[model samples]
Each structure stands twice: as C-alpha cells, then as structure tokens.
Target: MKFSYLGDDAEEVSDVLTRCIGPVRVQKPLNTALSYRYEFIAAGRVAFSRATSQGSLSIGQKGEVPKLLVLLPLHGAARVRIGRDDSLISIPGKAAILDGNRLSELQIEEARSHLSFVIDQGEIFRHLSAALERPVHGSIDFTPELDLTTGAGEILFKLSQIMATCLGDNAEIQELPSTLSHLSEGIVNLLVDTVPHRFSAALTEGEWLPSPRHVKRAVDFMHANLSAPISMTDIAEAAGIGVRSLQEGFKRFKGASPISYLAQLRMEAAHRDLLNADQRLSVAEIARKWGFRHMGRFANDYRKSYGCPPSEARRRLPLSDA
Candidate 1:
C-alpha cells in the first residue's frame, strides 16, 4: 500500500508525480536532494504523497484530465495559481484544491515541503450518484482555499493525516480487504459530506431509500459464492426475482448493471487472493485459480482494482516493511 522514491533525477520525480497526481513539469533550481513517499489506497482511485524538494513546478493537462488533486502543506508554504487569477499562498493551516482538467500551476519559491492526495473524479461521481440516488450533474467547484483551522476542513485534514500516517503500522487493517474497501468509502463519504458542492444537499440529506430486500438477497448470494462462475438468471432465481426486476434493481440500487457488479466482485476476490497469496504461487497461477481465464484481461482488471500489477502485489511482503 505504501511505496517510496528517493533520488536526484528531476525527470524521474516528475514522472512519479505524474503517476501519483498529474503531469507537472518540475524544476529544481537549488541543489537539494529529493525525497518522496507515496501510499496508494485500494481501487486505484485515491492516494497520498509527500515531497521534500525545493522547486517551482507547473501542473496542467494538455488533454482533459479526469482526476482531482488536493494539496496540503504540513510545515511549509507554496503559491498556487489557478489559471490567470490572483495567486494564493498555502501554508500549514490551509489546503488547496484543484481540478486536473483546468490549467493551473503550483510553485515553491523556497525549499517547500508538503503533502497531497490524488483522487479519481469518476470514482467520486459514482459514489455520489449512488448515495444521492440520481445522476451527478456537474463538477464540484470546491473553494480554492480551505480553512483548516475549523469546521469540516479541520475534520478532513485530521482524517487525511491519520490515513497517511497510520498506513505505516496498520498491518492488521491492511490485511483485510473489507477494511481497505471501507476506508476508501469512508474517505469518499467524508469528501462528499464536507465539501460544499452542487449536490451538497442531496449528499447531506437525500430522498433516496435503501435497496429492497430482494437485492440484498441477491448480493448475499454473490458474496457466498463469489469464486463460482455464476449468471444473472442464476442470481435472479436464487433471489426469487425475475431477471427484469433484478436488472432494474441493480441499476437503481447499485448504480451499475448486474453484470458489472459481478465483474467487480470477481476482481475484488482476485485482488484479495493476490494479497494473501503465498510466495510460491505466481500471479498468473492465482488469477487462473480464481477463474480469471484471460491472463491479459485479468492483469488489467487487477491493476485497476488495486492500483498495481498483479505481480507487484505478489511481490509485496507483509506490513512489517510497510
């Protein structure tokens, strides 16, 4: 879950930042050593990282970037420019939020050090859509400056610190797939509830009700036999619902079709296996054992679910070194 980078190459650091956050052209004016650490949460949607480098960096997107970047300074200062607007200074008590699709730049005049998080916009949108029981209509125009001294800003800052800091010792928590899933969902929920946005009301209080009992029964069936190759009709028959009703229920309640949910579960199960697998078992062997027939497709799906290749997960040792 946690990886680190320490080197002197600016381009390599830039590439790592591009992978962790966005495409940023980093310039190290002063001769200072670079030290960076990053931890990626599950589902490939969220991550946290820190950089100890003195540089002026430009972050932008040539094409539309489908992600959001949250920048927080723990002990230094930086100036941020959102397009051509007046530059904003961020220090330890404030956080900066930027949409990756927009043209923006972040610069560190001195040897500034800070922490930041990268989030997938589509993943947040999916969760918001599910919680609000409707399609999310627009992008969240977060206040560029977050006052971290009070209210929701304080809560988010503390939670993010806890997550990034505790990752080093939470071996028990890291071993549980459900815990990772819950942690990601909890963070997403915090973001939706705390930030003032277009769907803030629906996020705060929505008219949506929970999914019906039949849907729950179907989900239970899937969980019980997740490794078994199952079909929609099989699930519908077990849940005592027609295929049409089951399809509609999944679309409304799950925000995804039944087939998609099934695939998601399959991928999740495979990912868990990769994490818990023994060193003797190769990634391909584990994938095949879990009924992932196509090795190429399985690798891609596994990467998307866990934010790394299956081989990387297999190579990971226990959290003692995390």
Candidate 2:
C-alpha cells in the first residue's frame, strides 16, 4: 500500500503518527503552523514511511513499544532517550532502531524530516529463532543508536532507501507478493544477523579450528562412564579445563552442549542395547539403564532422532529390511 498526507493541524498529524507507528504522544510548539508531508508504503509486516514537520515537536510514549521502528533523519536532528538510562543524538546518516521493549522519548528540537521503518517484532523473532534452530524467548535488544556510516548499517540504510523508492506510490511491486516476501525476509534477516544480541551469537560464523585436545578427553570420559552420573563441571574438570571453556569448545567443535552430547551418547548406547536385548527387557528398562531419568522426554527425543519412539522400535522385528 502507498499513501501520503499533507496537513497543517498538529492534532491530526499526532493521531496519524500514533496509528502508523505505535501509541505515542506528540506535542508541537504552540501557534506554530504545522507543515507536514507524510508518506507510507507497506508490504506485509514491513512498512516504509517518511514524515517531515516544520513545527518543532516532542514525540514519545510512557510505556513499552509493540513493534520495531528504525527511524532515520533524512534532514534535521533530534535527541532520543530509551527507558531512563540510554540516550543519544541522531542526525542524517545516523539511525536509531527501537526494537527493545521500553519507554521511548524523541524530542525533535527543530523542523525535521525522517524516514521510518516499521517492522513486526514477531516476524523478526521468528526469523531469529529459525536461524538459531531454537525457541527464542524474551526481548532481543539491539544497540539503540545505530551508526549508519559504514558496514552493515550503511547497507541497511541503502536497502531501506531502495525499498522506499521501489514501493512508492505508482509502483507495481505492491501487487507482486513473491517479490515483497523476499524483500521483507531480506530486511528482517539483515537486522537479525547484523544486530548483536544473545541469540545472534549462535548464528555467528566461526573459523573451522581443529578440536582442542580437551574435546577428545571429554568425549572419551563420556563414553567410558555413560552409565555413571556426571555433571558438566565434573566433566570439564576431568578434561583439565574450566566449565566455560569446555562449553564453548564443545559448541564450536561438536555443535552441541556437553550435556546434550552426553545425551546423544546415552541414547545411542540405549538404542544398541534395545536392538540386542532379550524379550524380558523393556524399553523403559533400557532407557533407565542408560541413565535417562525422564522416559517421556527421552522417548520424544529418541523419536526425533531415530524416526520412532523407543517402545515402537523395540517391538519391531530384528531382521534387516533395507
């Protein structure tokens, strides 16, 4: 969708911005004539908009935001405050991306013109979760002040301009669903990959360094002591390393946690025993023998890894089918 609004009333501009962005209050200098030119272009969860105001204004909210907003000043300058601690000044080529859930304050001291990107927070999180291959909880916070002078920030700025220009009024891309979907995914993935956060660490590319000697020791210990109970700290200490080092090494070398790697070993051993067991042995017994404390969860993970629940696997004929 593409649209534009030109108005002189501050109240109407305030209402429009609130509806377009989020719940916000706008206060303009008294008796100053409001010259506003607002443009909007939207595709799916992504929207490109630019608003210019001749009247000095203060725009803010008392509560947390519901979506992510990337605000770039094409002209004019402003100071922004996030919650109560972080604050910054933004000008041309310097953008502020508000994806964090917090009260925000933006004071436009002089006549200002800016482009804004309104992205669905849920869509961003879903992309991040998919990239990490894990469930992402809590808010993914980025550096509030984004320096668009170089690197990823510059790319994001240019991409936004292209999206805004392409989807402007009279463009046919609004009718092209596949192209719009690709654009939306590109924008969201850009933010997810470029923005630093807790979840992004897992998605970061690292060099293929050889596994340190400790990793082999840890795996050997796990295999030799599969039936015995052990903790990550215990395994780390036995491998002659700290718990954190072992964790990072395992995540890098093994692509799994030490604890999770132990689970795989236990499950594999249990699978072999189940295949060779006599009729008197039960699936639950085999799982317990491998130190699997929770049969239900173990069954679920086993199903995911082996294509069947342990019980069903045990009941099947032992003859080779392949």
Candidate 3:
C-alpha cells in the first residue's frame, strides 16, 4: 500500500497518515501542509512502513488501544513531545519508539525521512504473556530510553534488513504474509530476551520459568563434547539427575530433549568444523566425527537446520587461520 500527499493542510495530512498507520485515529484540526509518500512493506499483526515527509506537522491525539510505534529517522531533525516532556531526536541514524496509547505529541519540522513499524497490541500481549510465563493482564508501554538502547538499535537494524530483503518490490509479495508473521514473532522474542525489565516482568508473571541449573550444566556438557556421542543417559549422569528429571528439565529450559539437543550441538559443531577446516573433509567423515553415524539422515537434518545442504555450509565459510 502506498500514498503520496502534496500540499499544506495539517488536518488532511494527519488524516491520511492516520488512516495509513492507524489504531490511533487523528483528530480534525491538523494545521500543516506536507508532501509525503508512504509504502507498506509488510502488513499483518505487525506492519512495516517507509515514509518520507517534507514540510511541518504536529501529530498526536488520543487512542483507544495501546499502540507501539518504532520510528527510525534517516534524515532531518525533530522535536518530539510525549505528555509534558519533550526531547530532540535527530537524524542520519537515530530512532525512537512512540507509544500512542498515552497522551503525547510530535512536532516534525522541515523534512523527515523515516521508517516505522506499528505493532499490534493483542499480538504483543500474547507474546509477553508467553515469555513472562504468566498471563499479562495490562498494557505495557515502551519508553524512549528503552527504544534507543543498543539492543533495540540492533533489533531495528535487523528489522530493517528483513523488511528490505523480504518486502522489496522484487520479493515474492504473495509469500510475504507468512514471512512477516514469523519475523514479527522473532522480533518479539528478541525484545523480551534483551530487555531486563521485560525479562524480569515475564519471570515475575510466571510467563518464563527459571531453568534448572542442572539442565544448563547438561547443555554445557553437551556443547563441550560436541564431537563425542552423547546419549540421554550420559547427559543425565553428567547432570547428576535421573533420566526422567533430565528429560523434563531439558524440555522446560531448552525446549528439547537431551538427545535432540545433543544432535543439534553435534550438527552445529560439524558444520563449523566443515566451514573452517583447512583441508576438505568428506561429508561422511565429518558426520562420523560429530557422532552422526548415519550420513543420509545427518545431511538431511543439517540441511533442515541450516536451510542449505551440509556441503553448502562448508563451502560458504573461509578456511581456518590455523
């Protein structure tokens, strides 16, 4: 979806923008004339937008449901006011997340080149509920400080990359709906995991239960011996737990059984070795070295995990310095 509005009239521009990026409907008295073009990249529970605006405008009013807007400004300067407090967030590579569910206002001066993501409240709440391991009954608003953090910046960069790659005009638009859905879920997971406040909230709510130390220790053991065959009993013995306990603990913490985790660890180790080895190794030899005795199943699993055949992963990485 795309729209270009030229000419001055704050109300009309705001109306158009609101209809374009909504849930926070704009009021009728917008007072600026702006020329703008907005393109909808990925739209679903989460919507991605790239918009460029020239002119002046004041945006903000009231809204019904909680709304989260992540805005990255590529050019120009602007003074954004949320409630009674105001801050100057400027261009080139700076960004901000605006929570429109609250009382806030934004004054965009001169020109602004921006990319934004509007996240659905229901979807976000569901994610929060799951991550926190408890029912999230209230709305959570992200502060500007949280939005500007290093981790948030990384997420925004990744989001932009995903949007660029998956929603480009040349991309398969027909497949975008499912792609966006998965991408949105990944974004939520990254946010919940990176933000201490959000992580703590999730823990407090029982949405994310603590993993047993033994389970973590078992995983460490498995990773440390990736080239060795690791059985469920071996992992259980290493963790000093019974087989049933080990299985349940791994399931709760890592979301996989010990044997499955071991297989994944071995596959990862084999892939890395193949990528970095100075001398080329046969697929069978590499699989065997990683405790994968069945070459066919190993190759199939590797392809499923890495989205490429094992040989491709080997070819993609440079030879080891050693």
Residue-level lDDT of model 1, residues 261-304, one tens digit each, is: 77776776676677686768787777776678899998776655
Candidate 1: where are CA atoms >4 Å away?
30-44, 55-62, 166-173, 201-322
Per-residue lDDT tens digits for candidate 2, residues 64-95, read 44368889888888888888798888799888
**Lowest-sum lDDT 10-residue window in model 2:** 313-322
Name the lDDT value of residue 179 in candidate 1.
57
> Which candidate achieves the best TM-score against the true structure?
2
Tell me the TM-score of each prediction against the true structure. Answer: 0.58, 0.62, 0.55
Model 1: pairs clashing at backbone N, Cα or C within 3 Å:
none
Deviation (Å) of 6 in candidate 1: 1.4
lDDT of 3 by residue, 216-258 (tens): 6787788787777567788788888999999887666555677
TM-score of predicted model 1?
A: 0.58
Ranking by lDDT: 2, 1, 3
Winner on TM-score between 1 and 2 is 2
State the displacement of the C-alpha of residue 214, model 3, in Å, after optimal TM-score superposition: 22
Ranking by TM-score: 2, 1, 3
